[model samples]
Structures are given as structure tokens and as C-alpha cells.
Target: MAKLIRSIVVSAPSGTGKSTICRRLLAACPDIKFSVSLTSRTPRPNEINGKDYHFISHEDFQRRIDEGEFVEWVENYGQFYGTSVKVINDALNHGKDLLLDIEPRGAKAIKKQFPDAVFVFVLPPSPDELLKRLKKRGHESEEAIKIRFSQSNSELKEVLWYDYTIFNEDLETAVFQMISIYHAEKCKTNRLCGKIDRVFKI
Candidate 1:
């Protein structure tokens, strides 16, 4: 039998450096594949279709929802975003671990469908540091920054439901931590059941 593929779901508030950490993790782990999400929102200037996100119309998004195509989905900032069940299962069936970058709400939804998935929550070193990072980004207005900062507080509460939490204070340290978790999980007894059975047979 082929080895079982694991899914890693990562969640973090805006400006928490989750994207940077995830990018590093993917570069370091060749066996892992990033799961691109479908979004009703328009692509940003540097965003590529089917790369950053699969941009679609509101009607199409709703149609997919009706068709039960998504494993999990949520509406944020007046736009819809979701992960397709087929996309996830297909990668896992091919023996590829999947890395999912989602918000707290969508993460919760995914947990319901895939209880065995590894849930990781990323956080800034401190609230003050989080504020600094948001401001340093220079992409949002003052009011928007304030709003995001406030939302981060509630998002932090969801960390309690996660399997692991990583403080993204230093990019290198954070990436190392994630890689460690990946390696540890791959060696877990439950994840190695197939190999264990074969060993016994031998």
C-alpha cells in the first residue's frame, strides 16, 4: 500500500508573517504541496490565477457551494473563499502532503471534515509587535490597520483549538519550527501504521 498523506492546516491573523513562514516551509519540503484556494474576490496586482488563488465570480462560488464542491468555505470582507474537496483528496491520494493557509473560521470548518489534519496557529511575538508589523506593511489605511489589529485579538482566541502554535517572531526560527513539526508528524505511530503492518508481516 502507498503511504498515507497528511494535511497541514495553518491559520494566523493578518500581518502575523504566516505567509512568509509557509513559503519557506514549502521551499524546504519538496513532498508538500500548497493548496490554492478559490475566491470570489478579484486578483491583486501581483496575484496570479490558479497560483495565489482561483478567482471566480460570486455566482460561480455560490453554485459550487450548492453542488457541495467545497470542503470548507467562509465569507470575509464581503468576498467568498473556499477549498475544494477534490483538490485536497487528489493530492493526498497521490501521496503528497497538503499545506493549507486559511483563516480561523475556515480552519474550524476544515477540522470538522478532516479531524486528522494537523492544525497549526501562527502568532506574533506580542500584541505590540503585531501592531508594528501591520503598520509596517503600509498597504492598509490607518482605520483599516486599527480594524485588523482588533480582529487579531479574537483570532488569537482560536489558537486554543489548534494542535500546535508557533510564534513568528524570527522568520528562520519559525520556519525551522514548522519543519520540525512536519517531520515529527510524519513519524507518528498513527501516520506510520502502514509501514508498521508491513514490518510485522515481514
Candidate 2:
């Protein structure tokens, strides 16, 4: 079977540990490339432009949008972020798997634009666990924590639309499950021809 590039979009609540799992998954599979979103938000102290995000000005971001350059764009937390259509097409054309840790709104947009993309929904074991994790971050103020918790119910409601739901109760276990899901996807006939050919040599 010829290599078929896969794109996976991950959606989860802010403190569900999806980012950590994604980092480990990248380390485990070097062929997979994580897509960095372009944003109008100001970069944090440690964030490097083009690495963490494109970090463009609002005017530039709007210009790109008007030019029809982005595959998916969404506004969140009073900032705009987008993924480039060109980059995603290039990655898939070369048989490289790409992953994007996108928000739910962006995930919906991407799914509409690219129906072949897989959607993974990560969830906390319980609301208490989510509260604990969010608090442990120590960066959010009490008001912000309360806001996140308030949004959790609405976010979890969207899980039903996803292809797969992963409970991030145990970090190691969840990571392995995600890896397994990707491996399983690679075997589908619609996704890969090499696997089918190898199984039946006529």
C-alpha cells in the first residue's frame, strides 16, 4: 500500500492534558508533524514566533483571511487564529501525518473543509479532576478557573460529534490509546493500499 498521509485534529478542554499527550505522541512518532497555528494574540514570554504561533498582527491576519489563504480560522478568547491551506496540502501530498491541537470551533470548520481529517476528543475523568488539573496550572486566577469550569459542560456536549473520545484519566494509558488509534487508521483500505496489497499477493 502506498503511504497515505493522515491529519488528526485534537479537541479538548484547556486543562485536559491533551497538549502533553500530543508532545509525547510526536516524540513517539517522528514522521508526524504538529501544525503551528497562526494567531493575532501576543506571544508569551517563552513563545517563539513561527514555532509556537505565527504571531501576526491583526491587520495581517485579516488580510490573509480576505486573500482566502487559511484552511480553517476561528476567533477565541478575543483573538483570531488560523491554519494555512497551503501548508496542510503540502504535508498531505508528501505522505507526512499532521496533527493539530485545535479548539472545537476550529475543529468543526476543519472537518467541513477536509472531511478526511480525523477528530479526537479528549476528556477528563471527572469534573473534580478537571478542576484539580486547572488549579494545578497555577496560572489562571480564581475567576478564570470558574469560567473554565462553567464552559466544561458545553464543551463535553460536543464530544458526541467526534470520531473518537479518549478519557485522559491516566496519561500513559491515554497516550498509548491515541497511538493505537492512529496505527489502526493506517490499516484501513481507504486510507492505505500497501497494507491490503501485502496481505494478498496474487
Candidate 3:
């Protein structure tokens, strides 16, 4: 009668609002759990150790890589980041849906390991609009923004591989679309025996 947990990976280019949507989704849907990633980058001024990211030295990250603890690892903008296979397996084993907000490359890696995992790619309504939003943030220099834009192109190229591509023009609308997907995934026959039994219940 209970819903089985599914692992869903959400990937997007920078400024696609994946983080905000993920946070809102968790707040709106209590049963969903996020995959907290480990990074070799330093924690930002406002970031906490575990909540924002598990910051570690390059040496430790390499050690983890050698240990084969991560499901997938990537080096982006001179920093390393990865999602742990153990973390995902533990959450799913406990009947909690696991949501991973990762890069396209990482998403591809996770997909290879977990064939049934759902992949969602979030995109801005238009590339121009995306550029505008990135500029408005004013957090990075022009060079940095350009580099991110380049990566966005790379991320967009892999959109066809995803199961769903949501245009995040409006935050609320996008979140609702994702919610609909999450609910639909829960109703899968493999996840819901109750639904199968309901027809004969009468």
C-alpha cells in the first residue's frame, strides 16, 4: 500500500534553477530525498559543510575515487565533484525517493549504472533568456559567465537523452510539472502493488 522509492536525476545548465526547484520540491513533497554530493571545492562564505556540499581536499577526493565509492565523478571548472553509490543505495533501500541534481555528464553516468532511473533536464525558455538571467545574478565575472554558457551548450546537447525536458520559464509551473512526473513515477506497476490489487479488491 506504500509507494516505493525511485531514483531520479535532474540535470541542467547553470542558472536553470535546478537547485531552487529541488529545494522547493523537497519542501512540497516530504517523501523525496536529495543526494548530497561531495566536492573538492572550498565551501563558499554562506555554505555549510554537509547541507551545501561535503567539502574535502583534492587528496581525499582522489582517495575516494580510488576506493570506488562514487557512482560517478566529474571534473568541472577545475574542481571535482561526485555522487556516492552507497548514499543512493541506502536511501532507496529505505523506501525514500532519491533526487540527484547533477551535471549532464554525471547524469549519463548514473543512468548507465541504474537503467531504470528517471532523467529530467531543465532548460530555460530560450538561450537569450538564460543569458540574461545569468547576467542578472551578477555573481560571476564575464569570463566565468562565458565559461558557464559554454557548458550550458554542452548540457543542452544531451537533452535528447533525457526522459523529460522541462522548460523552467516560471518556477511554480516547472515545480508542478516535476511533481506530476514524480507522482506518475510512483504509480508504476513495479512500485505500486496496491494499485494492482485494487481491481480485485471489490
TM-score to native of every candidate shown:
0.93, 0.89, 0.92
Model 1 agreement with the true structure over 1-202: per-residue lDDT tens digits: 4344468999999999998899899999989999999999998677899988999999999999999999999987688999999889888887898999999999999888788999999999999999999999887799988988998998999999899999998989999999999888887887777887888863
Worst 10 residues of 1 by lDDT: 1-10
Model 2 stretches astray by more than 4 angstroms: 1-5, 194-202
Task: Give the per-residue lDDT digits (tens) of candidate 3, residues 87-196.
Answer: 88888887788999899899889888888888999999999988988898887899989999988997799999899989999999999999888888877777677767
lDDT accuracy of residue 168 in candidate 3: 99
Q: In terms of TM-score, how similar is model 3 to the real structure?
A: 0.92
Give all candidates' CA lDDT scores: 0.90, 0.86, 0.88
TM-score of 1: 0.93
List candidate 1 stretches off by more than 4 Å. Answer: 1-5
Clashing pairs in 3: none
Q: What would the TM-score be for candidate 2 when compared with the true structure? A: 0.89
